[model samples]
Each structure stands twice: as C-alpha cells, then as structure tokens.
Target: MGNGVKAEIIAVGTELLLGQISNTNAQWISEKLALHGVNIFHHSVIGDNYDRLTSLFSLAQDRSDLVIVTGGLGPTDDDLTREAASEILKKPIFEDQETMRNIESYYEQNGQSMSPNNRKQARIFEGADILKNDVGMAPGMAVQKDETLWIFLPGVPREMKAIMEQSGFPYIQNTFPNQSPIFSRMLRFIGIGESQLEHELRDLISAQQNPTIAPLASNGEVAIRLTAKAESETKAKELVQATEQQIYERVGDFVYGYDEDSIEETVFKLLKEKNLSISAAESLTGGQFVERLVTLEGASSVCNGGVVCYAKSVKENLLEVPKLIISHYGTVSEACAVSMAVNVAKKLESKIGISFTGVAGPDEVEGQSAGTVYIGLYVDGESPFAKRFYINGDRDMVRTRAVKKGYELLYHHLKQKNY
Candidate 1:
C-alpha cells in the first residue's frame, strides 16, 4: 500500500563519517524497504551532533513520508538520535519504567553495576511506539509526526536485525498490506570479467524497466541481480526468471550457480551427480580449494581429499611429479600442473583430479611474475588439461582466484559432458 511513499535513511555515527565503519545499516534497511515496494530517495550519514541531526531529520520529514534511522542508540552522550528526535518533535524524552527495569536487570544478571549512563537507553521519545530490543540493552522506537513515520533502530547489526525481524518487519507488512513486494535473484558467474559480461548483455540492461538487471563484480566473480516488483511473489519470480532467460541466451555458459551458490558448492553438486570422486594437488593455493569443498555437508561422498604440496621436494616425493618435468617446466608450468593432477588422481584412486601450481608472490618465481597460475584437470581415461591464468592482485587474491579458476574449469568440463 505504501508503494509511492518515499523513504530516507539516516545513519548516525562519527565512525561512519571517519571511515572507521561502513554505513551498512542504510544499505540493509533500504533493501528491506524496497522489497516491500518502498521507495528510498536519499541516504544520509550524520555525525553525533544534535543540531545537525535535528536539521537532517527535519529535512527528511519535509520530503519523505518514511524516515528510518540507525545508530546513536548506545548508553553514551554521543548517542544523540533520541535527543534530536525530541527536539524536532517538540517532545521530552520520557523513561519507560519496564524498559529501565529490564536494563537494570541485564546488568544484575551479568554481575556488573548498572552505570548511570545505562539508564539513558531506557528513555524514549514521548508518545512514541516502543520496540523492545530482545538482543541488546537499548530498545528501539517508532514515532509518527505530521504525516511522516520515523523508525529508530540500534546501530549494532545484530540487535538491529533482531528487532526488525521481530517487530519492525511485521509492523511494516501489516501497515502496507497492498504493497507489491520486490523480489530479487542473483546469477553468479566465474571465468568472466565484468566488462565483458556487461558488454554481452548490454541490450538487456539498457532496455530494462519493470524487472531491472544490474551487474556487480567482486574479487574473482561477477553477479547479475534481477529485481522485480509484482502484486504477488509468484508473479515477481516469473518476471525475474523471464529476464534471466534472455540474459542466459547470450552468456549462460559462464554462469556457475544462482543466488547464494558458491563455486565449490556447484563443483561438489556436479561431482555427486556424476558419481565421480575427486582429489586435489596444490602449490600456491595451499589446501584452500579442497578445504572449501569439505565444508559442505555431503563433500565426503565425492571428495577423496587433497594434499598441499607446497615445497618442491614434496611435489617430487608426495605427489610424485617427475624431477625432469619440474625442472623443465620450473614447477609453474602447465606440464607440471598436469603431472601433479594425474599423479594425485592415481595416488588417491579418484575418478577425477585437480591441481593448482602458481606463483603467488611479492616477487617473481622461477623467472615468472607473480599471479601466474595454472590449473589442471584430469578425468579417468581421458587426456589431462591445464588452464593458465595471470591474475591481478596481492598474494591472497592470486591464491583465491586460482581456487575459483580450478572450480570453473571442473564445472565447465562436467557441463560439457552433460553431467
């Protein structure tokens, strides 16, 4: 029902302004509000100053019907959100007796003294609707003034989430029953750059309207989030899926999973479906590749295990890479990676094997530059193949990219074979 009502989020903290912390509260609240067809017009981050916050609040009330604020709800003088609201609304901060007793009891249960400052958390804007904080000491509040709704929440992510999920979400849902909820789905892709992927889907992105397509990139992967607003959840999902199909016609091969699926999870699912057991041999990526796989519940069924053959001697003695091959390829070549994968598969008696050998460094290795990576995949009774990559980033980034590349290679291989 609140589809056309505009909303503004104000994050109150000096830490946000100083760059010591991010204004994630605004991002999270905006997302939640948008899902219920609420329009967010502005995001503001203000320091712990009474005059400035009051002015910002008044500005928000002038233009927006919904004002959501986070932070400055702590038991300290710098926490000025309540004071600012009181001043702007011409109201006094009143103590809710039950809330004060609850605050005092919290300290008692923790074997600590309730400092006088702790009582400040119990004070609320006069006549405001109180939102009990189940997870923290400071409670939240919602107040209405002059056709605008003001939602005040704690700054802590944990407490804020709890209060919103417990009370705020229900309150909004009940108040705006006719809203066409926005639904979003994310399609994740690996082995592709953001620029290239967006270029391929440029037409779909440019012509988007009801269901909008937005491309985002982070670390070694790219994601496209499709958001659709419909009267019903089913209709919203259908709209998102229809747009997804259009994008898939162009760049579907690079998409490894949907929504929250990670590269490792996709690989694990493929291996299980193909009934193939897998092993790994590693160098620069250490045990990171296998370690991530094993975190999944059913990994033990398809994951035969892996070894971190970091040292040259270990590659020779443990994975049994031929001394001549290591010497000729200098341990970072496709030949060495293939040999490591082949030998590890045989050593572990797995149906499939993967290996990572790379130069992840601040300095060059074996005359090769840092971020030079090679990933090898060997299926039983088939020729082993290795992919080479030169990633850009620090040592950890190089290593992480190598792991993702390993999964991408395996996932594509399985897909090609109709697994």
Candidate 2:
C-alpha cells in the first residue's frame, strides 16, 4: 500500500484508563508503524471489560485496515483480548501446541509445576499465526478477518517491543510488500508564541498536502513537524527539506535548532565555540540557570560556576551587590540585577555574567507584581544591561519561562556576534 494503510492502536488495560499507568505502548507502536508508512489515525484505551473491548474491536474492523491491540494477553481471569477477538471474529479459540510446550519448558527449567490457568496464555484464534514471545509467557497473535488485519501483543513494554522487533514487523512487511515509508523532521523554534508562528505561516499550513505540516507547542517552545511519504527515503527527505526551507524563509529568526535540540544545549555549543567562560548569580531562579549549563559535557570549559542569592543579605555579602543599589532599587530591581551580574563576573573572572532576579510568586514584592522578572547580561567588551519582563503563569511557570527567556537572550547575543 502506498500511504493508504489506516491503523489504530488500542491499549487494553484498566490501569491505563485509571491513570495508574501511561499508554506508552500506543505511542511506541505508532512511531514504529509510521516508519512503514502506516497512517495511525486514532488511539484508544479500553478497560478490562469484554463487552466494551468487543465493541471497540467491531469499530476497528469497520474503520481501520489494521488493528493493533496491546494488553489483556495474560493468563489471569481478567485477561480478555483473546476471548474478545474470538467473539468479534466468530472464530473458536484453540491453544497452540508449540507455545504450550514453550510454557511448560520454561516452568520445568525453573523447577516449578505449571498451573492449569497458564494454558490460557497459549490460546489463540483459529487459523491465526502465532508470534512467539521470546521474552515473556504470552505469545502475540496475528489474525485477519474480512478487510481488517488484527495484531495482538503483550502490554509489558520490554516483551511488546521484543515481539514487535522479532516477528510483528516482519509479518507486516511480508503482508504489505509495496508499502511506502513515512519520514518526518522536527524544526524547533524559540522566542515565538505558537499562535504568532501559526499566523505567520497560515497559508502554508492551510494548503498542506503530502509532507504535511503540524505545529506543536511544549514547555515555552514550538516545533513544526513535517511528515512525508515516499517509496524511497531520499525522496521523502527531499520533500521534507523543501518544506523546511519555506518555513525558514518566513520565521527563520525564531528557529533555533532541529529535532531533539534543547535551548541549553544550543547555548552550551555556542559558548564552547566562542571560547567564552560565564558565571551566574541567581535570585528568583535559584541555581537552575547554572544547573542547566553544568549538566552538559565540557561545560567546565565555559561555566565558571554561580552564586544563588535568594536572600538579600547573601546578594550583599556573597555576590557583593552594592547595598546602596538594593536600598534604592530593592532586590528585584534592574539596578540590583545589574550589580549582581557585574559583581559575579568580576569575582569569578569570567568573560560573561548573567543574572536572574525576579518576583516569582502569588504575592507582589516591592510593589512589583508576581511574574515580574529582570535578566541581566554582561559581556567583557559590551555594556552590562538588564531587561525587565512580565510573564504570565504561576510561580513555577514564571521561573521556568524566565530561565527559557534567559537562554533565548543568550542565544541571540552569541548568534549576533557571528556576523
């Protein structure tokens, strides 16, 4: 099939519905299936109820070409995947002799007698192909009924992944020999709101087709995912790259990195490249700003360390923020922030110094409202400056966003020097 294969992932478990466990199986399966050009249109989670499971199976049969169900394949009384599949397909359930032998062999090796209920794990729909579970007890099954091809795998992540890698993928490839492959790329952007980014590319998004564009926002950053399907990987990449260039032509300034690139990582790379060392004095953000920097490898070369001056006395004594500035402008003032940045850099003898001082709270400080933030930056050759920002969120959101904005500012400053 060319991109015509429609797939749905059904995660069967009460724990998933109850939020005791996440439905990561569907996510993993969807990502794998996309590599084979299978379009995953829907995801569903059903509790261990037979009627509801059968109903979902019936719906999958009508709408999807492939239905992959994970969980409920155990030997316990609550295990109902095989029973529901049999009921939906009007087929009889029979135990596979090969799987039964493997189960008995496993228990024999462990010096324990196999329980009668354990036979339930070997049961499969009539005429179904068994996908051996090399890592677990219950064998996965693949059976076709009418137009729908159903694959049942274990819910345990390790076992599910093993079975898919060993047998499930091979089975799908052999069945659908002419399948196209789907390739996708994520272009990450910072300093741009999701709404504004969408508005800027409204026309490109509206007229999207193959190599579809989708914008996703997460943790103060936005990403554009471009997915393309082609018979060859090269062709798919070409389609994705062409679309990415169009996006860059519009809002290139905001785009920082590509897939899996974090702002901190980008900043660290830039610092290393410029042979620059930096120090920080954190007030409202605590040590989070420096904490992020030191996590990266080779950070010792660029990071000179930091001082967390949450208390006003510490800012005065340790960072030596001028008492006159704090008395006149308060601890959260731009003047105090500048002193903190300049003093920390001088004390640490670094080329650059950054400071975060703000009121992150449900209450105001020194007449400044909550979410009021000031970021101070000092480069050896450039003048020290502090920018005031009014963010919108709770205390935690404000702190997190403030840290991100600091990275954005640093990124722009370092990037500008390249020209």
Q: Return the TM-score for each candidate structure.
A: 0.91, 0.84
Top candidate (TM-score): 1
lDDT of all predictions, in order shown?
Answer: 0.89, 0.91
Question: Residue 399 CA error for candidate 1 (Å)?
Answer: 1.9
Clashes of 1: 2
lDDT of 1 by residue, 324-356 (tens): 998887899999999999999999999989999
lDDT of 2 by residue, 278-348 (tens): 99999999899999999998899999999999999999999988889999999998899888999999999
Model 1: lDDT of residue 105: 90
